[model samples]
Target: MSFIKKRTSHNYDIYESRGHIIGRITLLTGLIFTFLPPLFLWLVYGIMPPSKELINGIISISSVMLPVSIVEILAFSPMLGTNAMYMSYLTGNIANIKLPSAAIALEVAEVKPSTEEGDIIATIAIGGSVIASEIVILIGMLLIVPLSTKLNNPVIQPVFQQILPALFGSIGAYYILKEWKLAIAPLSVAILLNLVGDLPTAVTIPLCILSSILTARLLYKKKLIKVTD
Candidate 1:
């Protein structure tokens, strides 16, 4: 048993090390490709926005996005695992699409996040979702002109808005039911904060994460919740 455990640990370490290397390389490549279009226009046509306007635009966007980005990394990394995080960020639509897919995948696989099995499952799930989304997007593009009228119909607009809320609500309910004690603190904090005033997601996300962590620690300390290996 000891030898088997050691071998498993060795294999997992190698898996994680390779995951990091590949994730970093792909992410850096994606970043370079992301900037290539603007660089092309600037170099080939000498076409670029005014320096002052560009600086202001960047600051305005970065101020909001930087905090949110940092918070998302901290909040989602544990649940997403390293490779899934890199893939989801590279593909975008993480909150609405990739996150829910990963959550559902983990639940179905009966694997806890941040573990070796969970990491592998999540990476595979996210990869599948990315491909599925691309196919859907391609079909949408092909059909968009024909379906434009119906898609833009007032009655259908409300349904589109509710999709994300419904998706998250179902996932939240599942976890909350499974571990209501752990959910209480963060849920209460979120509700109270929202009731007081509408807090930006950047502000609320970190607070919620902190509350959940503290609550879990307190529960474990109190022997209210048992930790399992």
Candidate 2:
């Protein structure tokens, strides 16, 4: 028996497939993680107005850019879940405005296989679509420039280096340290990362996670520690 699959069309139906609770969890976690840092920073700034750092207006706009993009994204997501070509053939059929936008986005993101692999094509397509959506938003912002706020004043950059990491570390230490064993791995890895002059979280977090999991497993296996699910 062959373990090969056939070429499937990358249409709206791809997203149409239901029941991805893991994806939902990821999204919810995003909603939590992305906001909390900036919020705490804003609060701290408000409280003791940093001497060197001025919170510019653009930063404020950039801060809420997520919720705004989310609102726009939700407002225009397609409902029909049909092929883009078919949708283009009959764009008027869709009763909703958001459907057309989402359809357009799906069309933008669909991969056509070349000499390269399918995954590469899909990655390019999806990345292109995200860039396109951001471009559209930027265009909209330009149209209403007076209404738009400033983001990332130069003054805040240096301050961010100190405040952002401290905020995350403090919070993680507070909540995740309840389990002392789980706590040690992060502490160790954090120190390691700092000593190594800082790799990205992409490298740092996975290392810590794998180390913690293995440490926990080993300790339990040797009867040095107990695990509770």
Candidate 3:
């Protein structure tokens, strides 16, 4: 029975194998969509942006964006797990929409992320969110002209401009309220550094992540915050 069981193996491994295959297929499809459009434009027009200008643009964009993207992958993957990552990257908006939606779903389900159950919950949440986002985008596309006019109208511009800040502020306030002790040190440092007015944007982000992590560690060691199992 033992030998047969060993040979038979666990079903979870099979699921993981199939998941990897699906993820790779999705990644390939995403890459095709990404490159095919630009290639088509270049082929049809027989025109491309100036090589030097494109190179400079790439460099300027990559220098700042690449590091953040790498950091985000490292920082977020554990919370998102593999299935969620596939869905998130494919659909876009990992930070603003997918990640938050996954986090909230996991919290509601009372499951720690990266676990099997968490992966299932995250995948479901992200899938639903992707559908909902697409529907909203379709509606927006249909109303683009009117929406753009209203948004750009002088009376409404301030409100539109403030929407992002207000949204993040409310979300941040919710988490901070839940665990204010863990948030204080990082929030304080961010506020102080921002007041300096000359610090590089790239430097500020990693500094904030590090400071918050270290602060949390110190608090945990001091038992100011109870460590969960």
Q: Could you tell me the TM-score of candidate 2?
A: 0.31
- Which ten contiguous residues of candidate 2 have the minimum total lDDT? 85-94
Residues 61-130 of candidate 3 have per-residue lDDT tens digits of 8888877777678778888888788888888988778888998999999998877778778888999999
Per-candidate local distance difference test: 0.90, 0.49, 0.83
Give the local distance difference test score of model 2.
Answer: 0.49
TM-score list, all predictions: 0.85, 0.31, 0.88
lDDT of 1 by residue, 1-229 (tens): 9999899989989988998899899999999999999999999999999999999999878877888899788878998998899899989999778888998999888899988888889999999999999999999999999999989999889899988889889878877987899999999999999998977776887888789999999999999999665
Q: Pick the candidate with the highest lDDT.
A: 1
* Model 1 lDDT at residue 41: 100
Number of backbone collisions per candidate: 0, 6, 0
Estimate the Cα RMSD of every predicted model relative to the unseen true structure.
2.4, 18.9, 3.1
Tell me the spans in candidate 3 whose CA falls farther than 4 Å from its real position.
Answer: 1-9, 198-200
Candidate 2 pairs with clashing backbones: 57-150, 58-150, 58-151, 59-150, 59-151, 76-98
Ranking the candidates on TM-score from highest down gives 3, 1, 2
CA error at residue 152 for candidate 3, angstroms: 3.4
Q: Candidate 3: global Cα-lDDT?
A: 0.83
Q: Write the per-residue lDDT of candidate 2 for residues 22-131, one digit (tens) a residue.
A: 34555567678777876787787755456445467556556555454444333223322222212222222222332334434434555322212333333333444446
RMSD of 3: 3.1
